[model samples]
Target chain A: MKTIEIKHLWKEYGDNIVLEDLNLSVKAGEFVTLVGTSGCGKTTFLKLLLGIETVTRGKILLDDEPLVDEPDATRGIVFQRYSSFPHLNVVENVMLGEEFESSPLFGRSFGKKRQAIRERAIKILKRVGLGDAIDKYPSELSGGMQQRLAIAQALIKNPSILLLDEPFGALDPGIRADMHELILDIWKETKLTIFMITHDLKEGFHLGTRLLVFDKRRHDPDQPNRYGATITYDIPVEKTDNETLDEITGSMSNKKQEATL
Target chain B: MKRLINQHPRRIGKILLGLIPFLLILGVYSFASNERLEINPNDKLMPAFSTMADSMHRMMFEPSKRSGEYLFWTDTSSSLKRLGLGVAISAFISLVVGIFLGIIPKIRAGVAPLITAVSLIPPLAILPILFIIFGLGEVSKVMLIVLGITPFLIRDTQLRVMELPEEQIIKAQTLGANSWQVITRVVLPQILPKLIDALRLSLGSAWLFLIAAEAISSTSGLGYRIFLVRRYLSMDVILPYVVWIAILAFAADYLLRRLSRSAFPWQITATREAK
Candidate 1:
């Protein structure tokens, strides 16, 4: 079964329809990247996958089962800004997801469970090259380091599908490149299914095995909320240079127009 | 030594020299006034000074009585101890409540009016009702102190939580943090400095509530001591308690400032540069 499947999904906020009749499927361990201009509903799709936003119509399935109301360890998410807990050091932030792994009901603190969670967290931090920073507070680290910590936090549980909503969008080009490579390496090593939303077209092609391009029609200058925006194309990212990738994207857009007509 | 001297050579030298005589003059003036200003034996001024002298003497000479002894007039030391306990407990409680309420928008929105109403109720108004329920015991006093102080903590913390750099929240969430993880890890840390500040502000309220506590019920607190002295037209004893309250409040505030500095070193640098 596909790791994630979306069928006729639609999302709306107030009178605005964000995603209308969206259908897509991500195969097991496939790297799926979503790229679009601002307010193209890439973020909304990621949020929907994470179960943060509700669908107006249709359904999202994880491993052929419908995604539940609350997010579990089966699906992990990473946001654009580094949301490493300032109060908690890197280790604690990473271990936070472990609580969800054991049970949905909170407040079961066991020694074995705690140790297991800690080990998993440390392992993830090491994988992300943040083992040394496990004890450091988020404020003590640089932006890149904090983002890495955030990645570790999402990676700790080894979820079947990882949802990233512009995790490297805020970093400088150099750091962003490094993060992109790190994520690519991690995805290769773990073979984890990924659904990353990004605005950078180059980054999207490099990272995503399949790229989902959102439509210009979905964006409104007056009311711009990406979580409630319509998405359009679900294009496979062919291994090619920047010029070739753009041509592919253009072809995909034309196909969408034909389908709509 | 040479490097240090060069860094602040002329400024330090001038300031040190200038302060010597100014300090001496101030001390001499204070001592001279104490000796020369003779009020009528029956006048309120003489008794006030006597009370001040007694408190100073007790603080200097009687260390054990500060904690061990309990008397109607002897409350400065006890008041100091109780105030310390109140602050510690209130701070702990405030941190727990502040973080919980601050993170949950629904809870904050739901309880906003109730918290506001409770906060607006004067500490004095609650004293009688608290006394009736809890009696003239430590329970009522401590309860009043918490009620007086926690609302400010909640409001201040909620504001801090709201003001948290949106960048951090968006970043963490993108990283796959659930709501609890975000609250404890990101939001709580950033909001801590402001919360500590709120707690420090609440300290002054704690002392005020403590006095109110003594005033309404207790036979042996600084407030009660002052009330007792006022009855006898003994302004001297009353003055000491007043001075004692000021000193205690100052000391509490100063200690909290130091604590805040150690806990939030960033804020210390922030304030030092601002000054």
Candidate 2:
């Protein structure tokens, strides 16, 4: 069964329609990257998938089960900013994901279970390259380290789907490259279905097994509100060699140029 | 000279600089009091510092002939009890109401304006009404403090909760936290420092209301004793009482600051940046 399936989704905020007639499906382990211009409803689509926003019309199914309107542990998300809880240290932040599952009071676990969770948190932090910073607050860490902590916080829950909303947008190039490698490594290891939204076309193509472009097909200057954005291109990243990736990039750039014109 | 003072001041120099205005005030008071005393040896309007100290010692240490109770201790305990109860009640109510108003938009829209309106109603103006309904007892005084500060605290806490990043709420929910869990674990912990801050800001008004209520009706309290001695022009006793009240307020403020600093170190950085 497909990990996620959306049918004829429409999200309208009064007259300002953000998304319309959107349909998508993803296999269990596909790393899908969504790329679009700013305000193209890319983030909104990801929010819908995470159940952060309600669909105006149509249905979303997770593992063939109808998804509810509230966010759940079945899906995990990393926002571009404010993802990590500043008040919690790195280990506590990572432990929070697991903590919420067993104990709702937050960090109230005790005895062997608590020790085991702590060990698990420490292990996950080490995996995310944050072992040395386990006791440090998020504010004390650099931007790249904070983002890594956020990923660890999300991934500790072991959600079947991981959603990323421009999670590397704030990082410097070197850090961004390192983050891309880390994300790829984690995706390969966990085989969790990943949906990431980004404005960086190269980064999107580099990290995704499939790339989707969201854009409005029609523009009525007098009534721009009449149309909403939808997925325009869905390309499978043929990862056999560099030439295939380059050819896909070349065609995508052509499409982007034509759309801009 | 300015640069030297700014950059290379010793600790003693900084202490002396802080004391300048206080020393100046004391000098002026002493000069005026001496002139009055020299003119009229029985003048009671401006008592000397030693006279005030003597009165403080008597009130604080000696037991009353009739009740055998130290009036100073009684008044201090009574005032503290009322103040503590009032602030605690207000903080609890504000937390509960503020979280609801902040999380549920519908409730916020419906009740926020009402809260604003209620907050605008001068708490002092209804002092007589509170006395009439609750009686001129500890209840009325505590209610006055609650009435004076709860609205402001609620508004402050609600604003803080609302100002929290939407991403945090969403992130909390995505981590399998239900609505109650989100409010308790995510919202409450984050807003606790803000609540302390709001309480600190409202302390001035809380003291004002408590004094007003106590002065009007209480048989025993700092304000009651001060007002009672005012008719005789007992400047010595009145001044000490006022100083005692100041000390209490300062102590409360300092303790709350310490609490927030230790309990929520993350919040301290945000507040420092804001400053």
Candidate 3:
């Protein structure tokens, strides 16, 4: 069964049509990236999978079950702005789901659940290169560290699918590149299904196994029926190492001028 | 630090100096003069002050007088105990009700207008009716306190909950947090500082209503003691008791503020900027 299936998904805001009839399917353990410019419905597509924004018409199914109104432990999401609970240490944030899931209603107190959650949280933190910072709060960590912590939190649940909405969009280019590699590394290690949205074409080219390009030209705020938010242009990206990825990044610099001309 | 203290000590000095003139006038009026300052017995402030002074003199230097009656009925320990219990019980009620009214949208929408209307009613005005029904009982006093303070508490808690970040909530939801988890882990902690502030403010309000309740109906309590002293036109006892009330209020307010600061240092900085 497809990990996530979206058929005729339409998202609108009063008169503004953000996404229209966007049909896409993410296979189990596949890494798909949606890349487009801002306001191109890339974020909306990710939100559809994560169950944040409701679909105006089309249906989304996970393993043949409808995606619920709110996200569940089965789908872990990493946000762009890495603000979990600052009061919670890195491990505590990661383990939050495990603790909650462990407790059946009217179960043992918060203290008992927390202890088990903390142990698993630490193991997951180590997986994301934050072994030492598990006990540190989000504020005490660097931007990159915080993002890494966010990733650890998303992964700790061991969700079937991971949804990332411009997870490193706010980071500097160098940090973004590092995060891109880190995500690829984690995906490879866990072999988990991922649906990532990004505006940067290079990052999309580097990480995406199946690339979907959204056409911004179709977006019209004034007209409701103008275009869907995402018009998928499927592009294939060959699996490559850090060096080929760097070459793709360099070539993209030349494409920028060509596109402008 | 010394310079800051000394430079602004003028306001402090003036306040302290003002006390000396006040005590001198009071002493002269009470002991030195056979003819007392003419007080229209009908006026509230002067009569209240006069009775307080007479009670103080009788308690301190004079023996075998009205002080014994006052002491027996309204001792410091009993008043403290009753006020403490009233505050704890009423504040707990207010906190739970306020949080529910503020955070839960349906409850908030349903109760907001009614609670606001109830809040606008003068608390003291209801005392006579409450006295008729409840008849000089503790329940009447506690209920008066709860009625007086709950709306303010709910309003403050609601505002605080509204002040919490939409982003944090969305983040929590995306993290697989159910509604209950979102409330206990995210919403409660986020609004806690404001809730504590509401709690403190309500406690002060409860005290105000408590005094009013006692003054109106009771034969004991700090307020009743002051009321009984007012009948004799003893300002001395009244002033000291007034001073005591002021001190207690200040100390209680300070203690609560300190507790808020220590409990949530994150709130202090964020709440200040939000204001």
Candidate 4:
């Protein structure tokens, strides 16, 4: 069975359709990256996969079952902002998911259970190279370190699907390169089914096994929100030659500029 | 010459600079008091510093002849107890109600405007109603303080919760947190420091309500004593009692500030964000 399958999915906010005619099916342990111009419903698609937003039509099946209406532990997410809990230290932040799962009422663990959670959290933090900063608050960590903490927070839950939205867009070039290596390493180690959205075309081709390029195939100037974006190009990134990759990406960017103008 | 924008005074300079206004006020008070006393030896509007100090000493240290209680301590204690109880109850109610109102759209839609309407109705305007309902006693006085500050605290707390980033709640849910768990784990901890701050802001109004209620009807309190001495123009006793009230209020506020600082160290630190 496919790990995730979407069929004829459409999302609309009243008359404004944000995504339309989307169809995809993916086996487990595949790295899928999405790239599109701004305001093209890419983030909205991530939100839909996250189950925070409801679909207007069609269905998403996760492992042969319809997707749940809300977010849950089976899917983990990392946003550009990280969304780290300011009050909690690094270790506490990472293991909070487990705390919520095990102790549903208080979202806290005590005694031996608490200790077990702590051990698990610390082990994961060390894996992410945050061993020395376990007790430090999120404010004290640098940008790169905080992103690592965010990754650890997601990884602690052992989610089947990891959704990342522009995870490295804010980082400097040096840090972004380091992040690429780290994410690739994690994908190999865990065999996670990752769906990440990025603005950069080169980064998409370099990281994703399958690169899905989103664009609007239809538009009405009279009714600006009449048509939403759809996947225009689905490239098997590894099999594509460098010249073809450059040509496709270049044409897409030109369209992007024209649309913006 | 140092530019004012970048200039920060050293600690000693800060202390010395802080004292200048207080010294000037003292000098002016003494000058005005001596001038009035010289002109009319019986004048009571501005009592001499020594005379006021002596009255304060007697009011605080010595037991009253009729009641056999040190009036200053008893007055201070009674007022503080009422203020403490009222504020504690208001804070608890504010926290629970505010959080509910903030997270749940239905509850907020139904109740927020009612709270706003209640807050706008002057608490003092309803003092007579409270006295009529609860009677002129400790209950009425305490109720006044509660009714006065709870609305503002509730509103402040609700706004703080609503102000929290939407991402945090979604993140919690993605980690398998239910609605109740989201409130307990994510919403509660983040709103606490702000609640303490709201309490600090509301304390001044709490004290105002307390003293007003006591002034209107009470046997023993700082407010009662001050109004009691007003008939004879007993400035010496009244001035000391006033100063004593100010000191007590300042102490309570200062303690809360310290508590908020040490208990939630993260609030005072820099923002927790990545580039």
Number of the top-ranking candidate, with lDDT as the measure: 4
> How many clashing pairs per prediction, in order?
17, 0, 18, 0
DockQ of each: 0.20, 0.54, 0.27, 0.69
Displacement of residue B237 (Cα, Å) in model 2 is 1.6
Chain A TM-score per candidate? 0.82, 0.90, 0.82, 0.95
Worst 10 residues of 1 chain A by lDDT: A100-109
Looking only at chain A, give the TM-score of model 1 against the true structure.
Answer: 0.82
Model 4 agreement with the true structure over A84-199: per-residue lDDT tens digits: 88888999999898898888778899999989999999999998889999999888888888889889998888899999989999999899999999999999999999999999
**lDDT agreement with native, every candidate:** 0.70, 0.87, 0.71, 0.89
> Considering TM-score, which of the candidate structures 1 and 4 is the better prediction for this target?
4
What order do you get sorting by lDDT, best first?
Answer: 4, 2, 3, 1
Candidate 4 segments whose C-alpha is farther than 4 A from its true place: B270-275
Interface RMSD of the predictions, in order shown?
5.3, 1.9, 3.4, 1.5
Q: Which residue pairs come into collision in candidate 2?
A: none
The model with the greatest DockQ is 4
DockQ winner, 3 or 4? 4
Give the CAPRI rating of model 3.
acceptable
Top TM-score prediction, candidate number? 4
